[model samples]
Target: MDGKKKNLTTSWGAPVGDNQNSMTAGARGPVLIQDVHLLEKLAHFNRERVPERVVHAKGAGAHGYFEVTNDLTQYTKADFLSEVGKTTPMFIRFSTVAGELGSADTVRDPRGFAVKFYTEEGNYDLVGNNTPVFFIRDAIKFPDFIHTQKRHPKTHLKNPNAVWDFWSLSPESLHQVTILMSDRGIPATFRHMHGFGSHTFKWVNEDGDAVWVKYHFKTEQGVKNLTEEVATKIAGENPDYHTEDLFNAIGNGDHPEWTLYVQIMPIEHAETYRFDPFDVTKVWSQKDYPLIELGKMVLNKNPENYFAEVEQATFSPGSFVPGIEASPDKMLQGRLFAYSDAHRYRVGANHNALPINRPRNEANTYQRDGQMRFDGNSGDSVYYEPNSQSGPTESHQNKQTGFPVSGVAENIPYDHNDHYTQPGDLYRLMSDDERERLVNNVVGAMKPVESDEIKLRQIKHFYKADPDYGERVAKGLSLPVPQNV
Candidate 1:
């Protein structure tokens, strides 16, 4: 056998040193924009599909207001949350991940929960998912992970083998894969599930003191989920069931709401925290950092035009409004660029000019002239920030209270490696009935995976989470329990 291995290279043929993790200031990083490998990879991934989004293509949106109930001026200087009783206009979009524009609403998939708050400073988008944890923590593997979830290359159909194989090999996916196969996987309606920012972010007070924070939007309507049989039946009966429910509920004045809560950890606590605070695959326990009530978001108005308001709407987690800043979370750092790049490619460069995305304060950037530059390209103003013509001057008011960087730049993995403890803890918290349903649901999905090796490998992950959880899934799949996991 002739053995000739090759180094992995970028598009221009430069050999890559680290493809799994993006280049950062340090191992735990606020990802540098200079990571052209990341930018190029994400840019290419975003452009793979045109017009419609590559993921989250099927979605529904509504108008709402966020009413701050608790004073968080001590935690953050973000104007919207600075004063109690302050209200800000906002919009929210809900979508199913890995689904096409015409896919069913009741699929067993993660739901996108993106909110755009049009604050006085600018638009701040909290782009997240219904689940508080994610499948993977690194963004470089995102495109590949999504590929596994999408149609097979040769068959053009969903491949269970690829899905299970990828999830098995990547043990980091255990937390999210567990939740995705549990009762909460198929939410009863858009109003019934909780939403989470999922990534740890930074919050700065007036004193410029920063803290690591996680956001939770607890559903006021209560968390309700549909069983697999019911969800399957509904998917067959009405693919737009969720869309209709949201629109009708809002129209009939049955407004649904969620109380915004956050778990705030002091900045210094991050380095000493048991798990990687920035890892999107794990959650900061309420015990360590209790949920602090912040505000309430009430969605009472349905979109007037689906295509104009909902379809044309865009969001990016990088859209920040001072005091609120990005953390060193690798997945989040990748998303800060990926989401915006995706919007630019899928909805054009000037897509933000649309009413749905246009900020209340509007933008004052010198960057101009693409398709649909309808705002007169700044109208005779100088096209540079530091121009003598006084086009626009830099406002240092919104600077991040950035932390100091340490350690050499390398592809170091996250601080925590024990992924099973959290998932196991979550399993133990569930009731007996919930545990049974979780097992049955996970087993049902794994049944389509033909490879015994893949099946066993995944069972090992379950075993690692909880022995009972593992054995039940194994028995349901009619496979012998994995030993010595």
Candidate 2:
């Protein structure tokens, strides 16, 4: 039927040798900046949708404050966390991962939980999701992974074939996929779900000592969710149910609250940890490193103007203060660039100049005018640095923590690629009814995958995670169990 197979190439017709992993300095690395292909793919993905976010397009936001209850100066030198009872004004945006700006609120999707703190040092954003882990580890696969989640190019509609095929091929998605199909997948309300700084980050103290940390925002309202049937009904009946609930709650003075906690890991522990601590797809067991209470976050006021306060508001993982910094999470590393770039493209070149995104303290930069340069473009002062005229200077305290990289720069897969253990452990932790519901949800989704091979391949992942999980879903889908999987 065919004399030869045509090779896949880039937009410029350059042959793509590898389509999976991104180039990095070491096995567990901070993604290298020189990976042009990875950059090109992500940069292109960021701009695909015009005037709206390519992801996390549908969202709700509120005004809040984070109040420190205990001293953490020994762990982080961030001014907001400097003393007991210190409070910092903040804004939080909750969103659905794969939906458009007009999509239903109650759909089964990952909820984005991003917070921007107006600290004296600058605007520090803790951008993450409801779940602690994500579907993929490397940034190179992000564009492709999202493409599978979105509409098919040809049909312009959601395709189960693309979704399950990608998930089955990439077993690293098991942990998050399982969570997505669980009872908590469709939250009853935004206030009822937990939020996480899904990526590991570094918290450096005054002495330059660093510790790897993960952030968790436990909902004071308690965990609540909806079933597929109930959620679907609500989606049809009231598409703005979640949005209305949030706005009404604050208006009635029933303020929503969450307690912030962090799990701190020794900087040296990354070298000897069981799994790559830097991998965003994996989680550090709470048993290994317990949570320490940091602060309380309370949302008391809804945004007055949806377009100005909520829609125009931007949060980027790259916006860091002195003590808080990015870890080597490849997904996080890629996001640092993509988020800011997206904001610049969507919001404008001077997006940061927007009141919602601007720092509480004045910001002065030598870089001048672009689109939406509404404020004084440095007020006719010398725009060039190192000028004889008085000008703002860099802060030495903002220096990054030093770490060594020794491995060859290439597309290196993680050394410890045991993707099943955690999902297996997660499946076993649920009660009988919870497990039943999870299996039912997964089966319903997998039932429409269209390819027997894809279904069988994915079943192997379920089997590896838990025999009962595999058997139940297999029976529900009426598919034969794969042998020796």
**Candidate 1 lDDT:** 0.92
| CA lDDT for candidate 2 | 0.92
Name the lDDT value of residue 302 in candidate 1.
87
Residue-by-residue lDDT tens digits, candidate 2, 347-375: 98898888899999988888788986988
Q: Please report, in order, the local distance difference test score of every candidate based on alpha carbons.
A: 0.92, 0.92
lDDT of 1 by residue, 357-409 (tens): 99989588878899868778778777876667757676676667757888998
Error of 1 at 385 (Å): 3.0
Q: Which stretches of candidate 1 lie over 4 Å from their true place?
A: 1-50
What are the models' TM-scores?
0.89, 0.89
Off by over 4 Å in 2: 1-50
